[model samples]
Target: MEKETTRIEAFSDGVFAIAITLLVLELHVPLIEETGGGNSLLKKLVAQWPSFLAFCLSFFSIFIMWVNHHKIFKQIYRRNTPLMFANGLILFLATCVSYPTALLSSYYHTASAHVAVAIYTALFVCINLAFNLLWWIASQDRQLLRPEITDEGIKRIKRNYLYGIPVHTLAFILSFVAPTAALFLCVALWIYWAYTSGKLDLKSK
Candidate 1:
């Protein structure tokens, strides 16, 4: 237990860092030839808005997850095979976020925008599901959590996961008919998660 949780956290941090870093690959400046000339530089830069927007959205999503991951570690003090595997599920989906970000940037203005947004929302659906599983497994036994975490703290965490799934699923459903709305919901969900997770800090309870 001494080095167990610490090692898991360190490894999880690395995965999150890599995923966040990969998101930047989807963003690039307009090349000299592509800009046509210095006079047209602003126009070309403006055209890359989709990439810029998607990068920010994806960056913040991963950043918030990283923050909440730290918050979760503050409660979890033990590790088991199931818990580690559940956490790994989260890391896997997080690493894959860059792919959908790339998809959205490439297809945001095309007829395929709905498909791209659906894929992005779908990834989020899986992410929220993985989080729920991780929390559920860790909270099932006090042996896995810190001495300070109470039953209410566990409930709060569970409540957060419960809210996450249906909302993300709704966004996923909306993607087919309203990609822009679905995209907007993703932004809102991150903000909601940040707020809820901040208040649900288990160590404090």
Candidate 2:
């Protein structure tokens, strides 16, 4: 007997919520001396810009991932063992985001910045690859999809997912050579994905 997609989706949603919430823990309050005034506190906050940037980027990335996950699961009618494992992989990688976000926040501008950025981008690459695999598994011969979902829609989703692998891989490579540029590319990818909104036209041929 096949399992309903609801259980998987509910579990995935919990993971998303936990990951996003963990991101906030990376933003620490700055310590000030007794003589420090309001202006000094403001300066300290400004100095923690890297933490703010990492938090925003990771939050948006996970948010967009959750939205896309919802869109994909809407077309999936049932799940098998492999499909469950695939979805689990996506969530597993997503849960890893908090660690890298914290690393990037702490070392983004320090001498270890490149290493931190590389690890950060590498996690995203893994996440992207996991998504590609999950989509491929779910859409294979429409094996797990709803009856109303069309072949053309599956193909479109696969094509879009395929695009993410190389782009993220490139960003990972750039992390070694140009960490800042790679970080920017990662942000750009998130923005582009958010703009696309992951909605498929199930009625399309």
On lDDT, the candidate that comes out on top is 1
What ranges in model 2 sit over 4 Å off?
A: 1-3
- Residue-wise C-alpha lDDT for candidate 2, range 121-160, written one tens digit per residue: 9998898888888888887756678777777778877776
Worst 10 contiguous positions by lDDT, candidate 1: 196-205
| CA lDDT for candidate 1 | 0.89
Report the lDDT tens digits of candidate 1 across residue range 1-205: 4535999999999999999999998888888878788669999878888899899999999999998888888889899999999999999999999999999999998999999999999999999899889989998878988877778888888887788788989999999999999989988989998888776665554
| Per-residue error (Å), model 2, residue 116 | 1.1
Candidate 1 clashes between residue pairs 3 or more apart in a chain or in different chains? none
The TM-score that candidate 2 achieves is: 0.93
List where candidate 1 sits over 4 angstroms from the true fold.
1-3, 203-205
